[model samples]
Target chain A: MASALRVLGVDPGLTRCGVGVIDVAPNRAASLVHVGVVRSSPDLPIERRLKAIAEGIRAVLDEHRPHVVAVERVFAQNNRHSVMGTAQASGIALLLAAEHGVPAHTHTPSEVKAAISGYGSADKRQVQTMVARVLRLDALPQPADAADALALALCHAWRSGGTATGGGAVTSLTPAQRAWADAEKLARR
Target chain B: MASALRVLGVDPGLTRCGVGVIDVAPNRAASLVHVGVVRSSPDLPIERRLKAIAEGIRAVLDEHRPHVVAVERVFAQNNRHSVMGTAQASGIALLLAAEHGVPAHTHTPSEVKAAISGYGSADKRQVQTMVARVLRLDALPQPADAADALALALCHAWRSGGTATGGGAVTSLTPAQRAWADAEKLARR
Candidate 1:
């Protein structure tokens, strides 16, 4: 709460990792601090690809110093291949957050779509249009993945944070869920 | 030794994993190359992504790199994501040869696909045709994931590097999946 919050939304991709950071200043507008994609071709070796993704994101996190990270949650789209790859990339994004001690939250595709486009079933084009409008970008973002990831971050800002989030982070959790998680942790032993 | 060895193939993706590998050489090629997929998606949370995928593949033995560790038998696919967010990273790749001082292998997707396809199935479009032509690829190269993984490495010359496997100096088996693993070991003793 003391520190200014910056939200970085990532549309995780195995081949193309899209990262966008928005700086939210108190009583002011959210500025687009960073946006880009970590591009890796499917033709390269897996090891090299992973390093690039990790390093690329690490740079964004370190450079932007975002308070929390918001990522596009992985939704099962029946396309097994797409789902699996997205999950892996998402995992890496979480790892980046965890490693950095930054809390990372995942938003479902529908939820993300709804927040940005006001329609869960909104196609990629529609989501992009709204993201551009919300961010007040002069032109539509390039590489749909990048724009989508940025939009996810923007959605997080709308729902939470200083002016948003309704109440402090304490009320952020339901007592029941918190108790269940504590019990689950004890059970792991 | 005359019989072809077991090989496991791996196809890494966001959700629909395609694994198939078989042992095949100039002559000896047999047995099943384990194949299946783990699904993960944008719908799932970051933690679930790890849970769903089992976070990619791991093996029981250095059985893959049948030859030397210097050259990996199977080249990792160049899915840009694999490089940045690999399930295991260098520590995991060290598996085949790292512990025992043996070597791990690396292979490109095309090489592995070619081993199954007379020609390389370099693109996704070619995968179906190549998958259809699998007569010569499986000597003991197990699943498509295993086979593909090994094909990349074995393509380099299983004949010369026949000693690339157990004979290497690397302590191959990981503690996570070591030959002596048991419940007691995991009990924090």
Candidate 2:
């Protein structure tokens, strides 16, 4: 059996950067490894804020040693004030991935939502709930950023088909996911 | 008079990041120490592209030991596709500055233009021409990006008042700058 595939996900932002790591088994059950947010005070200069984010990401990459890293793609149409900071933070993540010799992928919000909740337009709460169920967590992750990051990781694992490993206890899909799968099957027919 | 201020300026882009270093005398005469662009193939992945830019900026920072790093402040209204790359590239420059313990500043396009050409609405050619004239270069710096980088450095030096050196041979302003200065003086009345 192949070993579980470990993935690191980043939800980039200037004031709050969320990061999470997970291991996915071949049967598609995902287990959480670590999750948290790295924050920098808004009062700091742009360089200092970015420096803090960079240090936080570097620490995670060094400790987790994930095989792959996934980051949320910042869209141009987003809030003008925040988008630049988001893009900057995302850039730091991608660069750190390269520096650490890890492959990196970026997913848009819609893509992550669809992957986790089986609906492209799924709201944030729905996506977070799905993530909690998939990982068998007792409760949903706090702060939308943290949940979004885990969803990004899970999205990458599922989208990058056949990448998960063979070893690990396989957990059945949640009823909501089963319903979505059945609905998709019916639509295909 | 204060010692000459060495400033490194970055006009950030994903494919072609422009970098320039200059020394500004207290008399406000600026000399170009270095100017060049760091190019990364668009064919490379985003991570690799950002990595290339980071390495290029790091090399300049280490070699030049500039007192301050100046980057072009990217606006949200620019071409959508290029703005993200520009912001990301700008992020790398700022992060490098923090890592190296150098002060970093960002100047808007108009700010740099006004400082270099005495007009906020100066076009690319006018700014480039003025950069060459200010540095006593026989030829205009090729590629708008390189010239823009130098202009940013000069702008930072001039705007940061009373920061240039006391010992360098003083050079008088050109007729064009003199005209603008005299015009401004008359307007104040």
Candidate 3:
């Protein structure tokens, strides 16, 4: 039985976190599964926002049952206040993944674009277009952030030999396949 | 035999994530347990940074085995770029707590200050002074971020009655006691 892999991609944020899920199988194309956003406000205390992020994300993970999580890696911010705040929100995403024993894969902005658009410097619209094309969707996903997240998940689905089932693989790769698998896993942006 | 509770407080960042752990008893105050920082740079891709943050935080969690994890909540920022970047880092901290089965808590800047100091609007110096006083330490914890994280943990320790070990007696409280508890737990600022 060929395994199918479901992936969830997260674009972390304090007020608006974009998320998407995708599924794929070995030697097969990727499929867009699900996508949405988790929105928190600045007026809300950090604790409340965290609760929202955590609960909302956990709901997504449980609903999708993705085998892998794709997270956009942290980029540097010039403003200290903004950087710290963003990092805190990202922490919530990581926590959600860890809770379910799903290992998170990270990808750079450039890497996601390069994998999707054949250019590292591709713009958001171009990447979105490619994501739609790859997923065989007629229309692009709403909310650019959601589209970006879906793109990240699709990137992972395309790169990693996906599971045939919509969820994730239950088996572990051998040491020989571990490094390549880790690289495949971690490289999903 | 009474079991001591170990709490880990984290200040999440893409460049440097500060971690501090403390041990506390029911009536006795907190003691410095362990402190660490995970550093990453923009020069490296976000994949590497996420891996570093994941590995470093896991090591800390494994080594310290804290019962609770407290992280400073994300604050508002005007800069869009910085906000996005830091949000990602905070996600890492959240992931660490969930992955390890450690209950996670979050504290706002003012909540932390009010817990450390008598007032919510207290300055850093005042908060640090109170932290030193409350913890009975010779000096304020170095690096404002680390101290802030430690203060956040203390704040959680205070409101949560320390380590979540002893359940608060559901005593009928005087209006004044109820007011104080409400203010302590629900105060916005």
Candidate 4:
């Protein structure tokens, strides 16, 4: 039997960085390993704030030692004020993943939503609900960022075919094609 | 006489990251210590590209041991395709500064131009010419990125009053006021 694949997901932000780790079995069963947010005050200097974020993420990476990392893909078309910070935070996450010898991948918000809820346009509440159901958690993940992180982790697992099935074939699909494929996967299950 | 203040300047970009080191005496006279660009091919994975940038900057920091770091502040309003990479690269520079126990500051393009040429609207050629003149270099700094990096270092020195006159007061001036003040400084010299 193939072993479970562990994934670390990051929804990067300067003020509130959300991170989650989960294990996905070959049969597609998912279980949470850890979930939390790293917060830095807006009042701190930019360097100091980024340092705090680096330390927080480092601690998580050291403890979890996940097989792969999944980060939310930020776009320039997003909120102009926060986009720069978001991109910076994501960079730190990606750099840390490389330093730890873990391969990192970025999934767009729509890809995450589609992977978790079978709909790219799903709302936050819907995505949260789906994450809870998928993980068999007693409650919905609080703070949309954390849920987003978990959703990202799940998206990576499912999109990569849970590693158990040798997920390489899934990487070639277009975004639209991937989304529908994910939706169909959910229907079959 | 106060000791010369050393600054490491970075014009952050994924493809061609510019780095320069300069020594500024209290009298606001600037001398170039080193200048170069770190290139990363876009064909590589994003993580590999970032790692190459990080190693390049880290090597420069280790070699020069500058007193401070200055990076060009990226804006979301800039070229959309490249702004994200620029911000990410800047993030690595700033984070490395913090890790190395050096202070880091960011200046916009206009700020660098005004500090170098006493005009916020100065073109690249004008700013490059001024930098070459100030540094008493035999020739122009090749590659616009390298020139921009040297300009940023000089800007940091001048804007911070070059550490000889105690630059705390300059931080309070508006952009227009600072540009005019810089112009006056050049006129008097």
Candidate 5:
């Protein structure tokens, strides 16, 4: 059996950022490693709130040392205010992943739901139940955001068909993946 | 006359981020220091593009050592795709400011236009012309984003009523300014 791949998934937000870590075996079984939320007060200034979020994420990276980082993709929506905050938080997640040399990917909400529950339009309750069952958790993870994060990690692991060995061993690469790798190399230059 | 305060303004974007630096005198006279755009190819992956932008901004910070950093505040608008990218870039600007210990501020587009042109609803040409005239430049800055960036820096300097020496020196503090300062302190803690 290929070694388990550790994935860190982030559900980015300004007030409460959800983070979950999981180890996925090659056979597609997933086990929970860590799950929590990073909270920042809305009373704070924008930059200060962002700083706290970045620091919180950095601390998580230091503690868990996940092989890969997965973030939820922000889409255009009617709630501009909410979307802007989500995008900002998502940027911090991607930046931290790059700073730590971890490969980062983004999965849409629907993609995550489909991957975990086999239904793109699965409701929140359905996703939560499925995530719990997949990870063998005795009960659903509190906070819908935490369950969403775990789903993101699982989606990326299954889609990529690769194990993230903290040491940076990628098992397979498609042309697009090769392009991403080349682009990352150029960015570091 | 007190020493001039150097300010770096950013009009954040994913594909083309506008950056401008200026030195504002105690008497409110402004002179341009640097103005340019950081371009990242759309063909690159999002993380790679973000990494390029962060590196580009870091290089600017290293070279300029500006007293403060100013970013154009993003507003909710139609076109969710564009807004998301702007917010992401804005987040990077704030994070970089904190990482380098430089105070960061945000100014709205109307605020910038009013400060530079005395008209909140000024047209693009009006803003470009006013920015050139204020800096005593012989010609208008190319690429409207660059000129907008210069306007953002000038707006913050005029509104803040103080220099950003990182020493908390200010002529006066409004309730909002005080709140921002307190939040920044808490973030640094």
Candidate 6:
């Protein structure tokens, strides 16, 4: 049987970046490995804050060593002040993923919400409840961002077919899925 | 006298990033060291393109070892299609600078135009012409982005007191300037 796939998810931000790690078994069961936020003081210079975020990501990567990374994609329609910082933080995440030879994927907020809660427009509370239930945790993860990060990881795992059916075996991948896997392998190399 | 300071300027973009390096003497005289563009195919995935940019900036930093790095600050009002990519590329530049122990500064477009052409709203052609004249180049640099990058470096140098009077020494810095300098030193340490 193929071993479980480990994934790291990042919710990029300048002041409070969220990171989550999970392992998805071939049978589609997911177990949370870790979750937390990397905070930077707003009073510091922008570059320093960026550095802090990068360092935090580096530490997480070192500790978790996930096979793949999923980051939230920033869109222009987001808050102006947040859009830029989010983009910058996302860049750092992607760059570090490339440097560490880990394949990185981006998931939109709606996509993550849909994957977790079965609704594209699921609110934060709904999403949080779903994530906690899916992971079978006793309590919801604190700091809404961390829950969102976990949802992103789960979304990628399910969308990529890391989950199996009732038969509990891997199914054949679609051509597009095969291509993405090939690209991920190439990127790692 | 303090030795001439080398500066690397970046005009951040995912498709066509511009890089320029120059040496500014204590008396403010500037000489061009290098100029080039980092191009990424639009057909590639966004992460691959961003990786290409980060690699390009890394190569420049390795070759130039500039005392400082200057990047054009990206604003939200820029072309919607380009703004996120620009911010991402800018983040890479700043991260690389911090990694290499080089101070990085951001200059707004208007500041670069004013420093080179004596008008904040100067058109591109005017800024290019002034940049060529200031650097005593035989002809204007090809690709307007490269010219803007050179202008950004020159602006940082001139404004930071790289050029001085007969005393040929730095003048008293403003409180903001002092704070920036302190941050740079701390980042290097």
Alpha carbon deviation, residue B71, candidate 2 (Å): 0.5
- lDDT by residue (B1-189, candidate 5, tens digit) is 248888999999998899999888766677889998887889876777888889988888999888899998886674646777788989999888888888898888877766666657879898787677777788899888888888788777766654783343464764234433432333343
The global Cα lDDT (0 to 1) of model 3 is 0.67
Looking at model 4, residue B30 earns an lDDT score of 73
lDDT of 6 by residue, A11-69 (tens): 99998999999988765577899999998899876777889999999999999898888
Candidate 5 CAPRI-style tier: medium
DockQ leaderboard ranking:
2, 4, 6, 5, 3, 1
TM-score, B chain alone, candidates in order: 0.46, 0.85, 0.80, 0.88, 0.84, 0.84
Residue pairs with colliding backbones in model 2 are B3-B165, B4-B165, B26-B165
Model 4 CA lDDT for position B113? 86
Query: TM-score: which is higher, 4 or 5?
Result: 4
Which DockQ values do the candidates obtain, in the order shown? 0.08, 0.72, 0.19, 0.71, 0.50, 0.51
Cα displacement (angstroms), candidate 2, residue B123, comes to: 0.5
At residue B84, give the lDDT of candidate 6. Answer: 86
lDDT value, candidate 4, whole model: 0.84
Q: Pick the candidate with the highest DockQ.
A: 2
- Taking all chains together, the TM-score of candidate 2 against the true structure is 0.87
What C-alpha lDDT, on a 0 to 100 scale, does residue A59 get in candidate 5? 93
> For residues B68-182, what per-residue lDDT tens digits would candidate 6 score against the true structure?
8889998876756888888999998888888888778888988776666655787999878767776778898889878878888877776666631211234586423432353
TM-score of candidate 4's chain B against its reference? 0.88
Q: Determine which window of 10 residues in candidate 2 chain A has minimal summed lDDT.
A: A162-171
Candidate with maximal lDDT: 4
Q: How close to the true structure is residue A80 of candidate 3, measured as C-alpha lDDT?
A: 48
Cα lDDT for residue A185, model 6?
Answer: 39
For model 3 the TM-score comes to 0.56
**What would the per-residue lDDT of candidate 4 be over residues B135-176, giving only the tens digit for each residue?**
888889989999999999988887777652225445677644
